[model samples]
Every structure is written in structure tokens, then in C-alpha cells.
Target: MTGTDGLVVGEEVPEFSAPLVAPDADREERSLSELLSDGPVLFCFYTADFSPDCIEEWCSFRDFDWFASTSDVQVVGISKSRSWIHQQFIDYLDLQFPLFSDRDLTIAEAFDVRYRVFGLFERSKRSCFLIDEDRTVRYKWVGQHWLDPTRDVPPVTEIFEGVRNELGAPETETFGFDAAMTD
Candidate 1:
């Protein structure tokens, strides 16, 4: 099926940033400018941290930890959840990735992913965007819990292969990364 770029292949990513959902006392902020400034970025937008679908999606990624290790991609889970709540969810689920709290819905708005889901309450849609090295969206996917995140998108292995084919790898390297090296 056709993806979010509409009909275009390469287009500038929608700009965005918001407060982090991590529960650390120091706290921090997330900026699309800052994130894409270094290199490729993958933004995974979920309704909330603890929802059944969100939980399953995160667990799928967690189960395949290698997605992060071998690819030149930066995976971030985004939601409108509060930082403290996000911390609890992460801790309870033992998620190793970083999640941002777009409490104000600024980032989601910019990305055009925030909207009213239940006809009464506005929530984040389950969407994913692949921003390339130049901060342009290369691919996009969005789902409203009709499918399973565990099977819908092949594990990080396929993602790595697709990305490597889309973007050239170093000449000396024989393969993409096999595990995520994050902080």
C-alpha cells in the first residue's frame, strides 16, 4: 500500500520537539532539530505507553534488541503521556529505548499524527516515520490498532536491510549493525 509521503519519495520531515517522558529527576527535552541534526531518525508514535497495543509493539521491538545494534537508525517512542507515567511504564516493561512526552501535543501536531480517536478524546495514532540522514522522511506507516505491531512490520532485521539498501553503507563494512548501541 502507498505510504505517508503521499506520492513523493523524499520530502522534508515535519519539524517537532517536546519534553521528555523519562522519569529522571534531571529531566530533558527532545527536539526534532537536534535529533535529525546528527543523522537518521526513526520516530515511533504510540497512543500511550501501557495500552495493550503499545505494550505489545514495544515488547516486539524489545524482543528483537538487535534492531538497534546494527542499524544507523535512532529509534524513539513518542506519546502524550506524562513523564512520571512514562517512567513507570518503561520501568514496568523494562524498555531500553527512550520515550518522549509530548504533553502539549506540539510534536504530534507538527507531524500530523495527533487527532481525536474515539470521537470524544483526542489521542496519538500508532504511526512510524523513517527520517533519513538529511532529515527528510523516507517512509511512513500509521495504524489504529487494527493490526499487530509484532507481525505488521518485520523485525529490525528487515528494517536494517531496507535502510542499508536505501542508504549506502560504508565501503569497508560487510553488514549493518546487529545491535543497538544507545545510552
Candidate 2:
């Protein structure tokens, strides 16, 4: 049930709920249905927080103008990390999107993105799904391996293109991190 070949476009994603921690530290439980209540979702599942790749990936989304301005698309990040870890990452990156704690891997199992790295370390593989309001996955990207930088990475431009193709929005450009602001 866990691999890149599992889920596919046009499939209705299974439902799941997990604990979510907002940037301000507000904690609550959220479900996929509740998330779609607002609009379509660009759901991303990462391996963990505080990792270099994850830091760049999440920050790219935060810095992307389209991500911030696209009101019709709800952005939610999920990982196996705990709420405290999520809080630290959010604060450190100044992320505007809320992240969910999938500590139990329920959602990852449902999406079939759960996998083990090097055949030992269990974690959520980096994946993304563009789900419509009807719960059908319109687009998806699943990595082939754990920490495979070439495939497991989220290229900002490609992600934005997918977002535009799925949701039809303002154009996007590669979001570069401002080093001065990070300091």
C-alpha cells in the first residue's frame, strides 16, 4: 500500500484526519473533508521537518507569490513529525500554511505514500497531490526513493505549473530565498 506506483490521477483519495498545528501554535484536529470545505487542496507529504531538503521545499512554497495569493486553493503540509517539531519548522520558516502531524502515518497509508528509507527507516515519501473539491486527484507526483534528490524534490516551477493547470490561476515564477531575510 506504500509506493510511488500506488495512487494515480482520477482516483478519489481516501479520507483521513490528523492533528494540525498552525503557525501561531493553535492546535486542532482536521480531516480531508474539512479541508476541501474551503476549496481544492495542494497537499504535500514530506519526510520530516528541519531537514535541509524539507526546509528548502517548504520555504519555496512560502515564498511563492502564487501560493500566498491563490485563495481558491488550500495548502496543507503533512509529515510524521510531532506537533512540536512542526511548530519549530513553521516559526523558523515563517510559513503561512498550516502543517499537520501525521505521526501515526494514517494519512500516508491512505495515500500510499508511506515508505521505508534504505529498507529500515520508516517515513513518508515526498509526494504531492492536487485534489479537486470532489475529492478526485487531478495531478500527482510521487518520488521513487527516499532522499532521491533528483526525483523526490519539489521543483517550485513545476509545482506552480501543476497548480496552474489544475486550478487556473495567476502565473508563477521560481521563488528564490532571500538570504538576508533568513539571517
On the 0 to 100 scale, the lDDT of residue 15 in model 2 is 84
**Model 1: which ten-residue window has the lowest total lDDT?**
1-10
- Clash pairs detected, candidate 1: 68-179, 68-180, 69-179, 69-180, 70-177, 70-178, 70-179
List per-prediction Cα lDDT, in the order shown. 0.64, 0.78
Each prediction's RMSD to truth:
5.5, 5.3
lDDT per residue (tens digit) for residues 58-132 in model 1: 887777654455446667788888888888888888776678898876666666666664445665556677787
Off by over 4 Å in 1: 1-9, 21-26, 144-164, 168-183
Summarize candidate 2's per-residue lDDT along 78-159 as a digit string, tens digits.
9999999899999999998899999888888888777666667777778888898888998887766545522367766787
lDDT of 1: 0.64
Q: What lDDT is reached at residue 66 by model 1?
A: 46
Clash counts for the predictions, in order:
7, 0
